[model samples]
Target chain A: MTAAPTRLACFGGIYSNYLALEAALADVRRRGVDAVYCLGDLGAFGPHPDRVFPLLADHDVVCVQGNYDDSVGNELDDCQCGYVDPQDNHFAQISYDYTLAHTSAEHRAYLRQLPAEIRLEIDSRRVLLCHGSPRRTNEFVWESTASDHFLERLCREADADVVLATHTGIKWQRQLAEGRQFVNVGVLGRPENDGRRNVWYTLVEFGGDQVQVEFVPVEYDFARLAREMADEGLPAEFQETIRTGWWTTCLEILPVKERRRGAF
Target chain B: MAATLPVIDDPRVPQVELASFDQLWFQVAGTLCNLTCHHCFISCSPKNDSFGFLSLDEVQQRLAESVPLGVNEYYFTGGEPFLNPQMVEILIATLEYGPATVLTNATVLKDEWLQRLADADAASRFSLEFRVSIDGFSPETNDPIRGEGTFARALRGIVKLVEYDFLPIITAARSWPEADEARVVGEFTEMLRREGYRRPRLKILPMLHLGAEVERTHGYRPSERITAEMMKGFDRSQLICDHARIVTDRGVCVCPILIEAPDAVLGQSLAEADRPFGLSHGACYTCYQYGAICSNPSAASGGGHAARPT
Candidate 1:
């Protein structure tokens, strides 16, 4: 086995937010990270779906397929976001249609080939990277809702010492039994609905038996992104979430604790 | 009327193994209910004491036992969960271990109870979700089924829950035809918004033809029972028995829906209840159709195009 890298940067759900991707990659390079990984969802909720591909390609960011990526790549009719509410589904369909129409055939093919999970050894600790939970790609593992035992079972079933996922778009970390950990490396595609116009990624450092997980906030050109979205005639609700951190659409999937934290 | 058919003694009935103990349910209020709705599957009523209230101590014990099983979520249901005096305390205790959802009729909710629960929910890391059962958008359509004046009373309770900043999910069993689902849901949403819920969350449930519903509507046909062939390549995760067990005053039952059935009681503890259950009941067919009907939308088994990664 090769020696485990000291520092690794991971982010999830690009959501066509190429600006944030560019800024986050530059920041990762400046920090001198040994490896960078992305947890799928390269399209949706932003303008210019093609802009995100070059960023990932140039940075050599290994990615695991997300639900959106799986849907768009396979030309699925819906985003497979697992929304039950009619209104949420309506807006999701709008975004999915826009994304599917804009994403190039080349990028779609590339997404089709991406792995569902990436396994690596970080200082002898088994680190598993997935788009959502280890068991399901679209599963929502919210901090307030996911029990410690449930997370531990997921990690144990996947046979990993540390599990990293990001479907809920909110960043959280839980210390599990036997000093293991589970981290949701929040998304760079959108603000975390905390009323801040900044997105986030995670920096994980492993030294000996200890692991350090840090949520690094990335500041990008939100005004430009908003303008671009408006120019593309995307829903005002999507642009609102970009300008203000509060999620206007897709609010139904949020659990009570996470939803209560936002202004929606 | 259709001819009554004999029960099938077929050996081909599929048995679903407990995949994981993800959801643990408690029949907190037992068979006691404030309102005897026409469509109540278990026929829960104020006078129905077939099942008794589960004490806070019993619930706490089960909660402790559920930890090792890696239960994903906790649920409370009954004739009405809030009727139990210790309902708030039980939910508060449950939030310590995991998220808690209570199925309730909005007719009997107390502001003080909501206040305590809201406080507890605010303090805990987990969420406390209230699923308020309201049959219709107006009294004209709902009163005949739920009881006279229940619609207004329940609407008031929902308003109070909103006042507590609890975005309760308004659940209604579909009493209308399947084609009218869109219209019925739209009306329900509009009514809720007018009644002060700016962002209404609604879940429409398929009627379970059992208990009181058997008398109101026709009982399930013998063909409704799940067959062995039906389980082939089927996602058993959609079935509540695959991932959940209910703790009642009697003991741990197979599910919240089948607590009254003679064979539904699995065992005395969570460990003993971790066994396969025969899908013989007609209600099991309903469950098979509507996956994870008892869980919150967030915790529901994704049933559509969203594939679960093996």
Candidate 2:
């Protein structure tokens, strides 16, 4: 069995923000990691969706298929982000339409061929990399809603000791039974709902039966991204999230605990 | 003569297998409710004793059983879950296990109960969701359906819930046409905002045409049953029976919506109830059309097309 990389830099939901992606990769390079992986969602909610593809290719970041990737790849009608509120879906549709229209055919093909999940072994512990949950591509798996047993079952069913997922856009970690753990590696696409203008990525390292998980904040030129979004005719709400570090759209999917923390 | 309803044993009716034991619902207060709502699918009323409350011990037993099956969350429902004497204790105990959501009319709630629950929620790692059912935006529109004075009482309950700092998901069964959702939801949000709920979370649901609802309006047409052909290319996980089971005083049923149906009872225990359920009823058609009707917006389970926005 090929041993998993000892130190890995994992990024989630680049969302076409090439600036943040570039910043995150450079940060990862300076800190030094054995490998870099992206947890899908390379497009949506950002400007010029095609720009991030070259960065991923240049950096050799392995990726899984996120719901957005699947939709853009297959030329589907929606982002499949699973927002049930009209306003949320309306904003999601705007973002999806923009991303779909902007993504290159070659990039879409690359997204089309990406695997749903990747499995690795790290010092006798199995690690699973997935976009949302291991089972579904778009499942949110918010911090407040995922029960311990639910995550335990997810890991057990996927035959993984450590499961890393990102689709909810927020980062959280829970230690489960025995030495098992689950981590939402956060996102490089946008700031978490917290009022901070910085995106995040996770660094996971394993040594001597101990797993160290660190969330590293990646700060980029938010004003530049917001300007580009405005230039591209993206929704003001998307630009607002970039500039203000607070989520202005897609608020319906948040559970009470997570929603309570946001400025909204 | 009336038309014969479809039976479960029919081979042509599609069967939905239990995909995962993700949501476990408890008919905590059984069929007894404080007020007789015109649209109640189960015809629950204060005088009805057809079903009885599940004791806290009983709920705990089921909760214990649920853990082994890897149940994700617990939902408490009924005529009104708060009508049960032990509803507060049951919820407090459930917070220890996982996230819990209780669907209530909110009229019978006590400050003490909300206070205890508020404290319990604050301490738990999981969220305790309160799905408060209020059918219409105004009392004139709501009172005729729910009962006289219910709108005011329920509004007070919502204020109390908010006072305790709980962001309750205001669930309203769509009493108006689907096209009016935006206006109605806007009005509802404004009402909640004026009543001191700064940020309101709302979920609009389709009415299940059963029990007293049939008398209120016409029941489901015979043509509304789920045929096997409809199962093709359709996501079965959209149906609650495919992923959830309800624990009642009698036994474990397939889904919360079908608890009153004779065929709804799958088995005596969660383990035994882990069988495929036949979608033979007209209510199954509603479930088929509107997926995840019983779940919170946070718990949507699929990755395909976007759902119809509420």
Kindly report which residue stretches of model 2 are placed more than 4 angstroms away from their true locations once superposed. Answer: B1-8, B305-310
Interface RMSD of every candidate? 1.8, 5.2
Pairs clashing in candidate 1? B22-B72
**A-chain TM-score per prediction?**
0.98, 0.98
iRMSD (Å), candidate 1: 1.8
Residue A59 error, candidate 2, Å: 1.2
lDDT of candidate 1 at residue A156, scale 0 to 100:
90
- Per-residue lDDT over A1-264 for candidate 2, one digit per residue giving the tens place of the 0 to 100 score: 466679999989999999999999999999999999999899998998989988888988999888888889989989889888888899999999989999889988998888888889988899999988887878889888888888999899888999999999999999999799999999999999899999999999988766899999999999999999999999888999999889999998888888888887
Which lDDT tens digits does candidate 1 get at residues A224-243? 99999999999999999999
Residue B41 deviation, candidate 2, in Å?
Answer: 0.4
Give Cα distance to truth, residue A184, candidate 1, Å. 0.6
Off by over 4 Å in 1: A1-3, B1-8, B303-306
TM-score of every candidate relative to the true structure: 0.95, 0.97
CA shift of B53, model 1, Å: 0.9
Docking class of 2: medium
What is the C-alpha local distance difference test score of each model?
0.87, 0.88
